[model samples]
Target: MTTMIKTVDVTTALSDVDRFCDIPNARISGEIFHRQDIYEQELEKVFARCWLFVAHESQFKKAGDYIATTMGEDDVIVVRQKDGSHRAFINACPHRGNKVCFSESGNARGFICNYHGWSFDIAGNLIGQHESGIYENSHFDASKWGLREVALIDSYKGLLFANFDADAPSLKEYLGPMAWYFDALFDNQEGGTEFVGGCIRSTMDCNWKIAAENFVGDILHAGWTHDSAARAMLGGAVAKVSDFDESYSVNWHGHGYEFAMDTVGNVAVLGESALNKYLHTIKPSVAERLGDFRSNMIGSVSSATIFPNFSFLPGQNTIRVWQPRGPNKIELYTWVLVNKSAPEEIKEKWRKGAMMTFSPTGVFEMDDGENWEYCTKTARGKVTAKQDLYVGLGQESLLQETDLPANVYSGQLNEANSRAFYQFWSDLLKAPSWNDVPNRNVGRVEAGAAAERCSLKEAK
Candidate 1:
């Protein structure tokens, strides 16, 4: 008989999540941050079904370079192949439960498990086992026990993503309209981007979603959260974000990206006069390579979360993954991405800038961590868990019909992106299987149709 653990009914809890995150009433139930059972369910349903960031291709400079990371709660090894493709494997020795790859990242010939002298190749094939004579009469099959490969792995530009559910849609399809904005950051230059610095990881007592949300469309927090840094740095033009109120986007998937339309917007946040100067110097080339809209975004400040937990600051060039530990903890891995062909000095400047703005001890990062930690703690009480938290800013009338790939809103200060994120979050939880999830194609079609109508009405 299957064990049916009970307390807060699982079905009822999921239904509540769906009911709360809907449009016209986009609210978040605090229990989402507090419930242990819900967190366990998310490990299987949400993480397993989603396309999650594993590693970047630039990290695989050589044939054997590999990074050991996580896909949701499961540890994974992302390795570069000799033929220029990538593979991800569950990081466990099939013989016993010991992790095969010990190091975070390095070029490896193969992995040898310390627990039982089991050896595996670069592609995760179990090649050797110690004391062959001891298992002569016992039934053990080496061929049947390679490190179990992750179901699917793919890359867009240089960012690698993996999904455990074989039936889930392709990474591009799952990304939906978010790809348009991603290209603005990734493919808008003459040469592509690469991860520059080594990883900076630190733990925080906050849910992964909290950090993801802050990055997505929480521009409202900037002038307040990083107020001191902005005042102290006072890099002339960078200080102008005090008046920012401009553009933001909401992807069909649960992704959120917000940016000020001001040309010097992003670099100003770093209090780095160098980035502002460099951006203006490269605008002509950026325009020629990526065309108008993307070129326009070149010097503008931007932040985005590629739903679930992968995020990046386009201006500052910081890319981070919020690796979930449990209901109230996460291990954050961050790296700085710069144009592969950028000057060494320019790249070095970005490294120092990222360190100042987002590294573990960085000012802005510390401020955001404090808020997320308290948000998680607040939900521990029964009364607070049931209270509906309002997140519906500009929900009913914010989205505007635009030429942009994703549905966009008119202002930088909006919560529509957060709403879309939570809506998709709810959909994934209630979806019985990948096939059962709501058809996003229909939503996109309807959204386009609505945009066209709005455009025609405005013309009249």
Candidate 2:
């Protein structure tokens, strides 16, 4: 039974997308977090068109190793091919849309549908089907019945990303200015980085943007929101605000990074003496390789997000993807990363330290989960949903003397990156195609003009 639907004008729909976010004034309407219609459109515009983090290269050591993951609402299977490269595909069987891969992860030669016995090889080819000889139509081409492959798959350093839009820019180009900053975390050492422990999965009763916006540029919440956890982890002092604090909040193409110049602030929070010691020992070398700005960021009290939903902590080394479950829920997938050249003991310490601090039962995670839940739950109120949330912390604070790329602003407390994030998000929601989306980062920062606008010292 096919149902025909009449088309309605979406001009108003497109026009209203930017209304939820007032970037100039740094006010975000609560409705964007809870609206069903906007959430549905996000699936098509943001997740479907962006390069989303899917897996890590270390997860697949041998041929045929695979993991079942999600790209927005769609189930995807990322596989390690025999050629030492990677490939990903939609995890649904073409026969009747049944899921083809059941396990979360494992090494398998191929995927077989539990229903109808249709099977696909590791390369996503239709290799077998149940007893196909009887009354096979000439039109039934086995070659055409294969599982659908993802449009593109690529990696940055060791982290893998997949894109569903063939028209989308390549991962490197899409990463843009953010890629330069990524080197501060991923390229600090020569041996490169690898995921140590397997992924830890949990669910949060919060809008996906809520969690992402936190990592994007919400260090202000750290001092107050996680005060107890910080005390437990770092002994007496929490992430307190000081008049002389030197840090930066930066964003480009929607990606955000906020950090303190104090190199061991976050590393000390891990409560691992050896790990903290290790960072101090390597700080000089990292500085030589990546420069002072990036090297100082290596283990600083920093939080960053790569556009839509990929986030990580530099010193704590916890990488996460906030996979959207619905408008008001997100499935959080987390992993611990360490440099391959680091000592084995350090790797083990990081694995356990991250587990204690950021995992499901982690002290920090518990506090964050509860808060984001309340944030989402309260927004459902008719009156509350109409309220506007302020994100104008550092609206008057732009930096120019710094060598950091893209929109550089003052301190760990600023909401500049958060505002930029919402602006890009709104742009994506409204743009009809990639061509329509504007590159706001171009000419965003002119050193001489920015330096005269506001000094970091005066802003603080």
Candidate 3:
């Protein structure tokens, strides 16, 4: 017999958004991370309504190529058609609920359900049925039986995303000022960036937010947490890189940046000479494409989260999609990114760099995984679940109506990003539409002035 799990009343729990929002210096309520009811609520409020990253354009190159992916745990097949447009549909058969396409990815003219031979074209049109005679007078319409389509789908610099809610804002609008940083990476060159190959998949017993928060806000962990790995590679001079002595920027949509020293601790593996050579080689190209400001960012270490579940570490060149398996479990998919126009040798070096630092087997990823697991386990205890967690490190330093182009956080080690993330989370949970997100913190047009002053001071 199938077991039935209890459903959580997220609407009722969300009524206390202010309670969760008020405690900036403590852990969020432990119950929020592990409650079954809250997880279901997230499926509706967070997953269903938000734009979710699905696949890279590079994955579907051919006219009939397709890839099976997911958006908030719902299976979807992204297809490239002869008309040069892309489309996505729920991978379930219309006749029955069986998954129509099972392969992870490949070229295909159409999908034929293994269950009953029901087929759909590249555009998700019901083109063929095994038995049309039986349904001739049964009031069956092929058009009506097509695979269910996602309400919204779009691409930005080759990254494809979808949303189930029709009323959500355009993907570009949703990305907000964070696009400036992405332009530094994705649109740095003429052809833009592309996924080098398939992604690395892994699972962990921890709250998905823990992993997301680490990627978005935890710049403090690199030095001490990965100290052993950094020391082994650097011959014990990891402090030059991992020390959090830099500025922070928290964007309006909860996307944020931690700008720290260029000497990432992991680069110790490449040695100073090799590391210097690598930087020298990429510097001119980066400057030519993105100008001096972004070129300077090339060496800085960063951890960025795009709202709910998408995150990318541009310094490490790793793109991650976090799929929530439960309140306390997450399935992670990671991809390595490379400039499409980069030299083969440079691409290879970047790949090696990524594999050594960010993959499932990478030293830093393992360190992060351990902490996430421990945090989740502790939060699940009865006493712990009742208490609130803290995140108010830079609350006082938040420049609410600043002249910066982005929401600037004061310190590298501050929790401003985490706080912004939870703020958006609570807002999303309560608001009925994405349009309801307040435009209270849009940044000024002249953002880099303060950053430029700091750069000059450092030079002096």
TM-score of each prediction:
0.90, 0.93, 0.89
Give the Cα-based TM-score of candidate 1 against the true structure. Answer: 0.90
* Candidate 1, pairs of clashing residues: 246-412, 266-301
Q: For residues 1-460, what per-residue lDDT tens digits would candidate 3 score against the true structure?
A: 1011112223433666666555445447777778777787788788887888988888877898887888777888888879877878888987887998898889988889988888888888888777867777888777778888877889999999888777778897788666666665677677888888677889999988888888788877776797788777567665543245555555556777766545333333534445446655776677676555566565566678887898887656789988999888889899988778877776677777778877888877898899998888887788887776878776677765543446776667778888788778877777766666665565453445544453354345
Candidate with top TM-score is 2
> Per-residue lDDT for 1-460 in model 2, tens only?
1011112122334558657688897799888889888898888788888889999898998999998999989999999989999988889988899999999999999999988888888988887788766417656777777888888889999999998887788887787766767788898999789999788999998999999999998998888878888898878876565442688888887899988887878878888999989998888888777666667778888899998999999999999999999999999999999999999999999999998999999989999999999999988998898788998888889876654557888877789999988999999888877777898866665423433333233234
Give the lDDT ranking, best first.
Answer: 2, 1, 3
Superposed by TM-score, candidate 3 places the C-alpha of residue 170 at a distance from the truth, in angstroms, of 0.8
Query: Where does model 1 exceed 4 Å of error?
Result: 1-15, 19-23, 235-246, 398-400, 440-460
In model 2, what are the clashing residue pairs, if there are any? none
**Which consecutive 10 residues in model 2 have the weakest lDDT in total?**
1-10
Q: Which of the two, 1 or 3, has more TM-score?
A: 1
Better of 1 and 2 by TM-score: 2
